[model samples]
Target: MNKLRIGAATAAVLLALGTAAWSLRASGAGHTDASAPAPSVLTVEVIVPQQQSWPQSVQASGSITPWQEIIVSPETGGLRIAELLVDVGAVVKRGQLLARLADDSLQADLRKQQAAVAQAQANLYQAMSNLQRARMVDGSGALSAQKMEEYRIAEATSRASLDSARADLDSTRLKLSQTRIVAVDDGVVSSKSGVLGNVVAAGTELYRLVRQGKVEWRPELDARQVSTVHTGQSARLTLPGGEQVAGQVRLVAPTLSATTGRATVYVSLPAGAARAGMFANGTIELGAQPALTLPQSAIVMRDGRAYVYLVGSGSQVTSRAVSTGRRHGDRIEVLSGVDASARVVASGGAFLSDGARVTVASVGSAS
Candidate 1:
């Protein structure tokens, strides 16, 4: 009986010891599995920066206008419009007759004035003869002293009357010449405000002329940009159809616009290249600038911030913040946060994280 009880107790103790050992081993293995690091393996593209020559330029936009617009009006009034010699869009030379007023009245007035001039000349001749005779008779007492002085006064009065008639004739002739409305300069007629047989008043606008057929681009830019631009700077403008036209800066505004807080830059385009009222966008080349740039595909933006994936040894990548500048083509200028020699993930930055391990499956071509 004693031996049987001792054997049973020994068996129970041995079984308890085995069970505790198995539990301890299982718990230790679970802890070791839970604490182990996860594997981070990814395929990525890498890039090495290469310095290249690049041009620096600024963008601008504005409307095209005539180099000079002139207002054409008539000098004389109270006459009917008789003839419109040229129409809108007509090329005209200086002093070319654009329109004619009813000259019948003017011609009649001119003829009447000519007759008056002839009568004035006849009177002047008569006055001269009388003055000569008065001089010959003066102091000779051909008549009393009072009579001689009266003849001299009469001769002076006649001469003054003849001069007044001649002045009236000259005035009438000038009015006749003004009956024809002519161009003041060589230009293309842009607008016309004339009606045949309709009476027009003096100084009534007849036509609007674009002087010399030259067009200019007037680009509005911020004051800071205006300071860098100068006359003679070359620029290229893009038209509505994407046609690029070259132009040269002709003038820079001396003062900024008070309302818009911008300055105007006048760029002259090639003749017949553009017309007034054309809106265009352009870039002013500021010359070449040395820059450290990377492929545009390498940049990543998150939470309204710019980032880049920098690749280090062992294919480990770090998410780095970067400040970027101008963008040229597919590449962007890196102002800071990455050195020239830093290798970066060319693309697929969105899948990258800080301290992530990666492998260069394919390397991007050098830019």
Candidate 2:
């Protein structure tokens, strides 16, 4: 019975020892699994910087206006419009008759004035002969001094009346000449205010004249852009319907407009079929500028800020803030925050983190 109990106790002790050893091995395996390092993963591409040409530019918008405009008006009152010789849009030369006024009464008055002038001339000749006779009588003492002086005064008064009548006749003739409305310059009639039998007063507007065939394109540019525009600068204009016309800058405004913060730039187009009020768009060439340019894909924006990823040694990338200027075709001008020696990431910058490991691929290689 003692041997049996002793054998049972020994078997229990061996079983307990085996269980403890298994627990220790399991804990050791767990520790080994926990201590193992994680795998490092990164994918990247090589970047290079190159010099590129850039253009200095300023953008603006404006409307087209006429170069010259003239308003024609009637010069005399009580003139009835008889005939409109030229209609709106008719080309006319300087001093060409545009309209006629009913001057029948004026003509009658002119003829009466001419008859009066002839009668006055006859009176003037008679008065001169009487004056000479009166002077001769005064010298011969055949007339009293008072009577002779009175006769001489009468002759002088008659001469003065004749001269006054002649001047009045000439003035009436001049007024009759003005009854014909004439163009003061070579131009097209843009507007007409005349109608048959409509009486017009002096200075009543008759027609609006615009110089024919020549039109000016006046474009407004901002004050900052105005400085870059020079006389004779080449400009390309895009009209309605996508028609392109080339011209040169003929004039620039000397003062800036306080209301619009802009000034006018006049572009003189070549002779063609263009009207004064045609809508147009144009671009003027400013001078060129040197700039650090990079592909547009290399730039990224975050939190309303622009940045580019720069690759350093060991295939590491660092995010750098940048100031940008004008954008060209497929590239952007870097105003600051990048040097020619730094390698800017051209793609896949959104997935990158600072200090992350990376594998740099060559050009044309898959990322």
Candidate 3:
């Protein structure tokens, strides 16, 4: 009976230990099943392309220049500049004196011409008296026909000499007036080449005037772009110092440059808006056009090409290459790629890959 009882105790102890081992194994398996991680999904915001009234424009870079540069030169030669009334950057009006030349010689010539006129008049009066006296003695043999002819010829000659002297006097007066250099039009002087007491010749440049103080922008464009631009188009430019100026197209070059294959488009700006020879960047307004645009953050650049992410039916994103156009503010023009109805990843596009699974964030969720 004791041996049988011991055998039963051993069997019961083994069965208890086996049951405990099985229970521990099942508990471990259950814990592992509950703690397993799920697949990762990137939460992102989505947007749809919309139609907006974006103004059409062409971007160009060029330099500022004077609209009309007038070269001021002396009309009379062999005269010295006695005084310079205007210097560089001096504003002047029409017919304003800019410089003065010595006029003493001209005044002296005027007096000499006047004295010659007086002598010629006196000779003319004597000849006229002789002719009159001869005519009174006609048919009386007091004067010969040849003598009367001589008196008439002398009177005509003296009258001609007097007219010549008057002409010389007028020329002298004109030269005297020319000694006073004056501005041709209202303008601001840009450069000065005349020096005080310096003798200058006729047609020599004395000063350079920016006519009307008007400045313009001259931007070069390719053959294709030149065809689209026309005169009277609205333009806006940013100066070198960040000042904005509005302007209008003044002229479009009829012919392109043979060497560079480019043409210049002239845009007229207001006076004092910008200085000549300044580099500027501007846009030519080409009217309004409907554009399908998206936020700039929605587009991503890779390998020099542009791309955008498109959401698919299965909550997955696929990258699509796109061609872009002009950019306005924070938005960019989508020339071709996805349709207007397609949902696109608005931001965080740089971190996304092709065919990546994504979770759409709620509209009111904090990004």
The per-prediction CA RMSD against the true structure, in angstroms, equals 6.0, 7.2, 4.6
Once superposed on the true structure, which residue ranges of model 1 sit more than 4 Å away at CA?
1-53, 144-151, 347-352, 356-365
| Model 2 deviation from the true structure expressed as Cα RMSD, one decimal place | 7.2
Displacement of residue 307 (Cα, Å) in model 1 is 2.6
What is the lDDT of every predicted structure here? Answer: 0.86, 0.79, 0.89
Residue 267 Cα positional deviation in candidate 2, in Å, after optimal superposition: 5.0
lDDT of candidate 3 over 1-367, digit per residue (tens): 9999999999999999999999999999999988964343688888888788888788899998899998988888998889989889899999999989888888999899989889988988998898888889977998888988998999899889889988988898898899988988999999999888998999888899999999999999998888888899999999888989999999999999999999999999999999988999999998889988888998999999999998887778899999998788899999999788878998888998987888888432111
- In model 3, pairs of residues that clash are none
TM-score of each: 0.79, 0.71, 0.82
What is the RMSD of candidate 3? 4.6
Order of models, best TM-score first: 3, 1, 2
Error of 3 at 281 (Å): 3.0
lDDT for model 1 comes to 0.86
Model 2 quality (TM-score): 0.71
Best by TM-score: 3
Writing each residue's lDDT as its tens digit, candidate 2 over 170-239 gives 8888888888889888887778877778898988888888765466678898877898899988787787
Question: What's model 1's TM-score?
Answer: 0.79
Better of 1 and 3 by TM-score: 3
